[model samples]
Target: MWEKNGIKKNKAQNYKCTDCKKQFQHEYLYWGADINIKRQIIKMLVHGSGVTDIAKVLSVSKGCVIRTLVKTGTQVNLKSSKKYYHKVQIDELHSFVGKKEKKVWTVRRAIIYAYDAETDEIIAVTAGKRSKKQVKDLFKRLNDLTIDWFCTDNWKAFKEVLPYERHLIGKQFTKTIEGVNTSLRNSCKRLNRRTTARAAPKFLKESL
Candidate 1:
């Protein structure tokens, strides 16, 4: 049994467990400090709620949401449900980070995504300069998959690394992956066009 101990500093009534002598309050003074807020943050993130939107809805600060996202990201590990991929589509999206991240007027980062064309599921993702090296790192993550074909745009970078016979060029081969762009932009505020929200450099990969 828990008995009333005293009034907490937040004015909420505090209680003490008789067996363990542990103390707790039914309500918290800081909303973000609650464990449930972390769960709600993830729930809002998947349900098309942005940082600002979640802050308002949960009465927490934007910093709290970002911190929770970073922490939650570390705990998540998504493994491939399948072993082989016959066809895959590769794409890059242009996104921005605040000037604080680079000390420039604005920095544009290319987020590369590799999708299994057969199932329309993401295989790997990387973010940084749109160079051959970036694509190389993205491919490294998919090295375990027995990929038979890769479909990408006429971007010169991919040609330098991927084999010629296994590569398919042009947007026509990327129909399934193209549809994902719309869904991502619709659900993520940072990816939405004409948005003021900018992510920090470290969060680029975690947010994806």
Candidate 2:
């Protein structure tokens, strides 16, 4: 519980997970952070602040910053479908993830995005491998949209999932989504090359 002066009024309750038997604090404010402070942390993160940078800015511990990010990242509504659109562009971005003593794991964690041509908006984003099944699943999420045309690279999945009449296979047609990929790589440290911010699949997925 919190008091009128914005300080904690009661001791945190401890609850154990049924399956894991792990004790965790059940606090009203996540990690004992004030609501305003949490919002400021989120804003800083969106504006390209690294975890350590955010921690320093807020005068908090690095672990606090990381916990806030993990809590906020996974809570996002990623699968919300948009309204109908006539023109859309789709593309995939592949990158490496995971690690081992002998060798690093070369995973095909592709970021599939759909860009609305007329409005210059990114309507959808599905992160997974560049496979036929995943591609079809992404389009299925956008089935409500009346897409008359789709611009994409010469990926065989596009040809297999969508009708040829509606699909335009060319790099020239997918400049916007490519730009988005570049922006993501530039803004996110984990997505950058040769960075210590690299993460495994689960952490990477949530971070992005």
Candidate 3:
């Protein structure tokens, strides 16, 4: 069926399988336009195009574009093996929903940023809902192997919830987190104006 649609088949070259040893034709299957569309989607994403924009350009649904991107293995890197930043920053940002007439609803998300303050390199990011319990849970889910200092603004929730593990609160201590919040806000168009309907919570979380 695929071969009838211009799919090409090549001889299996240097191919070995543990389950079975067979020399079968390796076929590449796709419609010509699909290849172009996929490349366009990837290129747009590389150029910092939002998912909605990519979908519009490709004439596909936003969900389809998102799933395709995920299938293509494009995702944010959240792991840092090196203990580059002993001190981490924490903050929260809110997103609003609803249009001109209806009252807007707000949803808050917590952002945990690990950064090398000296080099200004963002090492890792963890996001969750804005709540003492949620923030504490986020920390608990982290690998406790690294004992680094945590700094945040005088958010009383941090003082009460974060474990006694070298945490500090003060204006100076939270500068990095504040900077991160600014960067994150600007990166996602939905959050830039503060009045736009928030992106789906799951998508926003994944974007982090």
Superior by TM-score: candidate 2 or candidate 3 = 2
* Residue range 7-122, candidate 3, lDDT tens digits: 23433233334455532234323321254666787777766567777776667777666556655642465565564356776665554444535322222344454555665666
TM-score of each: 0.62, 0.57, 0.53
Candidate 1 residue-wise lDDT at 174 = 85
Estimate the lDDT of model 3. 0.57
Task: Please list the residue runs of candidate 3 whose C-alpha ends up more than 4 Å from where it truly belongs after superposition.
Answer: 1-43, 65-77, 97-111, 131-145, 154-157, 194-208
Query: Which residue pairs clash within candidate 3?
Result: none
For residues 112-131, could you state the per-residue lDDT of candidate 2 as single tens digits? 77887577777766655568
Alpha-carbon deviation at 32 in model 2, angstroms: 12
